[model samples]
Target: MKKLILPILLTICVIAISCQQKEKQNSIPKMVNSDGSYETVPLEKDTLVLKLIQNSVRNVKKIENAKEVVNENLQKVKNLVVEACTTGDKPNIVLMHEFPLTGYLYGGRKDKVQMALQIPGEETSELCALAKQYDTYIIFGSYAIDPEWPDHILSLTTVIGRDGEILKKIWKPRNIKRFYSSFEITTTTVESVREKFIEKYGIEEELPVLRTEYGNIALSTVQLDPFIFSAFTMKGAEIILRTSTLFFESDIIYTAMANNVYSAMANIPADSPYGGNSMVVAPSGKVMARLDKTTEGVLEAKIPIAKFRENRKLPQYAIELTKDIFKQYQEEIPANHLDMPKEKLPQNGKEMKVLLDSLSTWLNQ
Candidate 1:
C-alpha cells in the first residue's frame, strides 16, 4: 500500500510539471510576418489572440491601400506637369522666313543700364515678323498695355513662335518669373555690389562709369531662376532695350554658333511655366541630351545622347544633376545616421533604412 501511494505521488508531481511546461509554451512569444519581414509578438495568445491577429491583418491591408493611394497621387501630379508643356503645336517651316528677328537679354531693373540702347520700332516689328517667318521663337522685351485689358500697364516678356503664331500673344496677366530666379549676379546690380565692396575696402573707384544708377522709372525686372531675369522699360508707349542681368547676355551678339548659341533668343522668363531645364529622351525613354540650367540662369548644356539612355527610372535630368552634385561634393553629405534633420529623428531612421534597402535592391537589379 505504501509503495503504491508513493508511486501515485510521483505520478502527480510529473503531471503537474508537464502542465506547467504546457502553460509556458503557450505564453512564449510568437513571430508574425509583416510586409516582407517578421515581427515578434507583443503579448501572449489567449481567447483574444485571434481578435488581435484579425486586427493586425486589417491594419496591413490598410497599409497596402495607403501605398496604392500615394502612388496614384504621384502619377497624377507628374501627368499634369507633362500635359501643361504640350499645349501648343509646332510652327510651320515656311512661315519662319518672313519676319526679321532681333533678340537681346536684359537686366530687370532700370538701374542696370547706364547708357541707352535704341532699337527702332520698325526694326522691332520686322524682327517680330521675321521670327514668325522662320518658325523661330523670339522673346522681345517690350512695354505695352493690352487694348482689351486696360489699366494693366506692364513691361512684358513677349513670346512669339515661328508659325506666325504668338504662343503667348501677351503674358503680362500670367506671373511666370519666380520659377527660374536663381542667378545672383546681373550687370545692373554688379556696380552696386562693387561699390559696397569698395567702400568696405576703402578702395577708390577704378572707373567713373562704375557709378550706380539711382532712378525711379517704373522699370520692371523678372526673376527667372537662379541665373536669369528680364528687365524692360515702358515709357509712355515705347519699349527699349535696357541692360541685362546676365554677364554673358550680350555674348550671343558675337558667338551665334549652333553649339554655343541658345536655341532661341526668346525663351520664357527663367521661372516661366515651362521652366524645367529640358531633358530629351530616346523613344525607349533613355536620356539623350539635357538642357541644364547655366550659371547665368540660362538653359545651356546639351549632354551626350548616350547618357540619356542609361537611366530608365529616374528622370535623366534629375539623375545627371544629382550625380554631378554628388561627384563634386560627396563629402558634404552626412553619413546615414547623421544625415537627417533633428526634427526628423523619430521617423527618418526607419524610412531611411527602408529606402537604403530598396536602393540596394535596385542597384543590384
Candidate 2:
C-alpha cells in the first residue's frame, strides 16, 4: 500500500510540472490599445530586422570600368550582409545608398548615357543573385538608361525580393538641375514633366508605396519633403526608405515621429559635399543606429511592426493638422507643385521670392 501511494504522488508531481511548463510556453504579453482593445504583444515573426549600408561612392570616369566598380561595391555590401547575418538573428531587408554600385553622374548627357545601365541588366542581375544568396530583400539606387529613350537617363531605386525577383523600380521625380557651364540644362516644363511620368510609370502620384511581407515600404530620393512623408503615411506606409547622395538630416527623425513609422536614410560617405551620415529612426523618433559621417558602414535595427502600428494609432501632430484642413484643401493643393501649370507659378526666381514675401506678410497679418 505504501509503495503504490508513493508512485501515485510522483505521477501527480510530473503531471503538474508538465502543465506549468506548457502554460509558460504559451503565455504572451498583452497590451491595451488606444481603442480600449487588448492585443497580444507581437512575437519574433512580427518584427523586421534591416541593415542599411552607407557605402562609399567611387566615381569612375570610364564607362567600361563601371562593372568593376559595381563588383567591388557589391563585394563590400555582401560582406556587410554576412556580418549582419552572423550577429544573432539575420536581417530581413538590406538597403544600399544611392549609386552604391554605379557612382552618380555629374557630367552632361554623354556622361549620363555612358554611366547608365539597363534595368535588370548586368548590375541588377548580380545584385539579385546576392539577394537570393542571403535570402533577404535588397534595395539599391542607380542611374538607369531608359530603353525607350537612349539619350535620357532616370534615377532608379530597384527593389529585389528574397526569391531573387525584381519587385519594383521607382524613378526619382524631383530632379535637381545644376547650372553648370559644361552641361546643358534641359528646361523641362510642368506639363512635360507630368506627361513624362504618366507616359513612363502610368501613375500621377510622386510617392508610390510597395506592399511587402515585412511592411508597406515607400522609396524616395534625396529630397526630404514633409508633405511627401505625410502623403506616404496617409496611404498606409509603415516603412520609409530614403536612398540619397545627401547626408541623413533631422527631417528623417521628425518624419518618423510625425508619421509613427520606421524611417531610414542611406547616404554615401562624404564623397560629395552632400553625402554622409547614414541613420535609422524608430517610430518614436529615436535614433536606433547610425553610421559615422566619414565611415563606410552598415546600420542595423529591428523594427517592431506591431508596436509601430500601435504608435500610429496614438494621437500625432501631423494627424491633428489634417483633421479639418486636409479634406478642405485636398483638391486645392497639387500633388506635385512641379505638376502645376506654369501660368499660375511665378515667372522667375525674383517673382517667386516677391510672391513668397507677400504671402508671408499676409500670413503674419
Q: How high is each candidate's TM-score?
A: 0.22, 0.69
TM-score of 1: 0.22
Model 1 C-alpha lDDT per residue in residues 1-365, reported as the tens digit of each score:
88799899999999999999999667643322223222112211111100000000011123225334324432432232223222232221111100112112132322112111123333345445655544444444433333332222233434444444444422221222112333222121212223333344322211111110111111113322211111111111011111122222222222112111111221222333332223222223233333333311212222221232222121112335576775775322122322233343222224434433443433445
TM-score of 2: 0.69
Model 1: lDDT to the true structure? 0.27
Best by TM-score: 2
Location of the lowest summed lDDT over 10 successive residues in candidate 2: 183-192
Predicted structure with the largest lDDT when compared to the true one: 2
RMSD of 1: 30.1
lDDT of all predictions, in order shown?
0.27, 0.68
lDDT of 2: 0.68
Look at candidate 1 and tell me the lDDT of residue 70. 29
Segments of candidate 2 deviating more than 4 angstroms: 1-44, 176-192, 271-275, 311-365
